[model samples]
Target: MGHADLVARLVEAGGLPGEWRSVFERVPRDAFVPDLVWDDDRRPVHRAREPGRWSGLVHRDAPVVTQLDDGAPDGVGYVSSSASMPSIVALMLDELDVAEGMRVLEIGTGTGWNAALLAARLGDGNVTTVEVDPVLAGLARARLARAGFRPAVVAADGMAGWPGHAPYDRVIATAAVRRVPYAWVAQTRPGGRIVTPFGTAFHNGTLLRLDVRDDGTASGRFGGDVGFMWTRSERTPHGSVEERVLPGHDHTESTTDLHPYEPVSDFDAGFAIGLRVPGMLATVVHDGAPADGRFTVYLMDPGSDSWASWRITPRPRGRYRVRQHGPRALFDELAAAYDWWRRIGRPAHDRFGLTVTPDGRQHLWTDTPDRVLDLVPDPGKERAG
Candidate 1:
């Protein structure tokens, strides 16, 4: 499968607007993709060595990691940058809802494919993209030029935004952010739109589309399942389950009838819990390599050096083992968050919305702006270490 095949698949899936179909078809995703790509295992796959595999991945409807740990030589660590999945790219573009002659500002120009799509839809002169990493920005600029489209590829911090070309008609971020930068809102004109992937440490994230109001504030709701890598400045603290939840650590033992199935795995529950219990990360480790159903769900907060382990066995019969360490009882906090969610009619993610003021404060609400989610952290439950 190649570019045409990918476009056909996207069209078949149905959000490829008539206009965008031509844009997607015209701009070659392969040209924007680098010769060096990383596999799911974080191992580098050079186009020269694995041409077929590289082509397949490039054309596949999945995200392709383009850089790891900011291109550090300390060996492949985490996915620092990637060519976002084509479907998500199309979805975000569709949500962007750009029109001809509309000035657009794009954040996080990873592979330049998204920016190319934007430039193709709106003229090159109307599109401006920002990338924090100078190297990635330069490469993306060259790729965009090679593909016959040259939008202003500014090598600057995307979070700050390319303010020189302010008052954009639309602003979209390819990176996820915990806080929607006021610069983006301030740079966008009244009635403009800002679409971004917004998430907290507890969750990978969902799509956020904010409408910039005349009052210099933007407010919008969560609607899509688009999870992008966090901007460098707002990245969640990183720590492995094994690294944080060690056996030697002091802990308080307890039991909970609450299973990990709903709280940790369910989309709605996890999203709600993320909003309630901020800065928490969960990881699951199975008991046996033979593929046993029994596993342990570990919740960690690297910021506070706190962790909680919830073990589940086949036929649990509602009794699960839970052990928590550090001053903050992560298990208790998560359980409380889950209880709160259940208490309030069990809302879906779409019901959640956020408002960003000019001062850069974010307010999360349920259903409407007035029905705010009480997100203030409890001092006992969320103390800094």
Candidate 2:
């Protein structure tokens, strides 16, 4: 599709704004993408001046992986940086409500595409982006400058929120953070908006948009689902699933008499489960043949080294079995959350909201009105070694 068609699709996807469609059409996505990057299939693809192919690739809904293996672009390890998919970036910008002349602070400046767009919307002087990786930051700075857009590009830990330019009108983080940094809340002006993908031990990311209140308490609804690169400081390998014990199972198998398996990506279902069963981590693993597929979901806890596995059989229907085991019975918790979701008529994303206090306390709430659930630890405590 051409630029016009692409922009139209983005609008339909609720990604591009009516006012910003022109900017999307004008800014060359191909310019910001590095020469060497990975495509959707995780295959390395080089960008060349083939107007037909390059334009199509840039317009696709998939994210172009810009940095791999912690900023190593040579495809040596995991994805660390990316020009976030068009829809995801648009969704975040929409939540941010960035307007002309607003001072914006963006964390995780990866390929400079986002920074360029911010510069395009709110003049270069009004935007400041912080990138933790020196190499990535330098490349983004040069790329933005070459594209005729230059924001205050700083190479510093984004967790700190660049105190030199305090009190920003809007603060958005491109990276996923385990805890909402106190610095971000402090730097945002009262009534200003702060948007970020708050990570949990859950299966998906939650898009949090909080309004900074006069007393430093921020509250708002969870806007949508997003997946982002984890902050550098929080990056670590979650030990192999095999090492963790599976609840109620003596060994791995193909079938059992538990909850039937269903293959559907329901964000609300996962979020509700996460909230109901706090501190539980679940990972989805797809296996078996294409025609006869099977899925194994493992739920575990890092603090207790406990876990459970649910196996779904392909009886050409949604049939599955859930087994509980381990010191912390994860399967039982998951089953309880699943039943709760059903009892509540499967609450959607709109019903959920996030409230963050000045002291760095975060709460996830449903519209039905219950006390906010605290997801982070107290700031005063530290690991006792």
Candidate 3:
């Protein structure tokens, strides 16, 4: 589709305001993207700024990876930055509810494409964005400047949030976070909105919108499914495999109770299990073997020096048997969370909400009984904004 058609489709999709169609039409996506990067399938390709080809990439509904492995040329490791997918960006913007002249603070500047969109909607002076990497931040600043849009581009830890531009009308994070930062709530004005992708280390991402209160607390609903790179500080991989992979005595016995079962994919289920079981690292394993193939979930808790496994055996009838092993009984925790979902009759994503306290505690809430669980942070550790 052409740029005009893409913009029109996005508007018709209803995630972005009608006024944004013009902004999308005006901004050239190729200007902010890198010379070459991986596509969605991890294929190495160059999205060269050659008019027709480049415009095609921009107009596509998918997000193009602008920087892989934190801007590494080899594209090894994980995805660190990108020009966010059009639909996800539109969903986040809708949750942000940014108004004309509203002051906005964006964490994770990435290619500065989202910043440009925000600047176009809220005006340049109303937007302030922070990027942790000096090189990425510099490039984004230059690109935005070249695009004739200037927002306060700061080279600093986004987790701290740019205090100089405090009391923002909206604070949006492009990165995924396991816990909502207190600084974001502290920086947002009363009744202002703070939107970020919130999930456990194990699951994909969910966009959360919380309204900040004067008491430094915030609450709001989970907007939709999202996926983003982990915050820079929480991006480190955990170590010590033996303790997490081996079976232990405390492992819970498997039960026939399927009350907690929620129909989530292996990836999402592993993530949700990891979050529910604090201090435990969860991983999904697929052997690619034939004949009723199986998937296994491994949970490691270094603190307890224990590991556990949940083996899911699929039957011909589309049912699964969850077997548990190891001292920690990680599958039990997962099953418990699944049961929680079942007890609530499998509530929709919008029915779930997140609350953040000034002390950096994240709580997940559901409408049924309104149960809240604290997403406590690691002790003696402080993360950058």
Candidate 4:
């Protein structure tokens, strides 16, 4: 499809607002994207080899993989960077509510497409984007310049943010984070908005819109659903939990009525479970026989040897077999989380909010500040947000 058709579709879908329509049309995505970009299937779609296919993918409302494994050798090791889907970009920008002449700080400069759009909407002088990868940063800077835009592009860790241009009116992060970095809150002006993808170790996240307060606290509700690539410094090593095991671990046998897939099968439930139980990596392993009912859910703690596995049969109504190792009761914790979710009427992501203090203390709340949910309770702090 053509750019007009793509922009039309995006506007129809409520991704691109009327105000951003002209800006989106001006900055062509093709200009910033690399020639050898990866498709959704992780297969390389070269512009030289197939110009038609490359253009189609570029104009479509989809994310284009820009860098793999931080530009490491090997065929698509992992998606280190990407041009976010246009719709998601629009959604994040809408949540940001950036205004004319407002200074914006962008955490990730992936293909510089987002920065270009922001620069178009808020002027090049008002936009500053930081990228940790020097190569990506340099390339993005060149691309923006080629596109007739010159947003300040800094090559440094985005987590630290561009502190030199402190007190921004808005801060937006294209990268996903486990916690809303304190630096972002500190850098943004009071009452300013910070938009980011807040994910847990479970690898799922919701777009969060936080507003900075005068007392060094930033709080906001969750917005749209998203799962962006982790920031460079927070990126975890690739490998299954089973690959790394400790010697001194205890094992216990148990059975529960809850199926292993119950919590994770649904996005809202999984997000709730993740918030309730932090620092957990959950993966489902199919035993090559979903028809025969051989499936297992593995839960492991990244910080410790605590791991739990639940094997479920194909039958819908039955007690599933469970095995847990290490000091933490992984299965039991999940059950509790599920129960809490149920008790709370299975609240949606919008009902949830996160508050981060200057000291990096995060508190998850439901609706009001007083009704805080203690995901990881700190000894000195109270549950009150």
Pairs of residues at least 3 apart in sequence or in different chains that clash in candidate 4? 293-314
For 1-385, candidate 4 gives per-residue lDDT tens digits of 7778888899888778888899998988889999989887888899999999899889998899888978986843699989999999988888899889899999999999999999999999999999999999999999999999999999999888889998899999999887777999999999899999877665467888899999999998885679888877666555574574444566888888887565877778888887877666788888886676688888877555578888888666677888898778888988898999999898987898889988889888999766788676211111101
Q: Is candidate 2 or candidate 4 better by lDDT?
A: 4
Q: Return the top candidate by lDDT.
A: 1
* lDDT (10s digit) by residue, model 2, range 84-150: 8888888888889977778999999998988898899999999999999998999999999999998
TM-score of each: 0.95, 0.84, 0.82, 0.92
| Cα lDDT tens digits for candidate 3, 47-118 | 554555555666788787777676666644477777888878877887788778789999999889999988
* Predicted candidate 1 versus true structure: per-residue lDDT over 93-148, tens digit per residue: 88888888899999999999999999888899999999999999999999998888
lDDT score at residue 209, model 4, on the 0-100 scale: 88
lDDT scores for all predictions? 0.86, 0.74, 0.71, 0.84
Task: Identify the candidate with maximal TM-score.
Answer: 1
The best-first sequence of candidates by TM-score reads 1, 4, 2, 3
Query: Looking at model 3, which ten-residue stretch has the lowest summed lDDT?
Result: 376-385
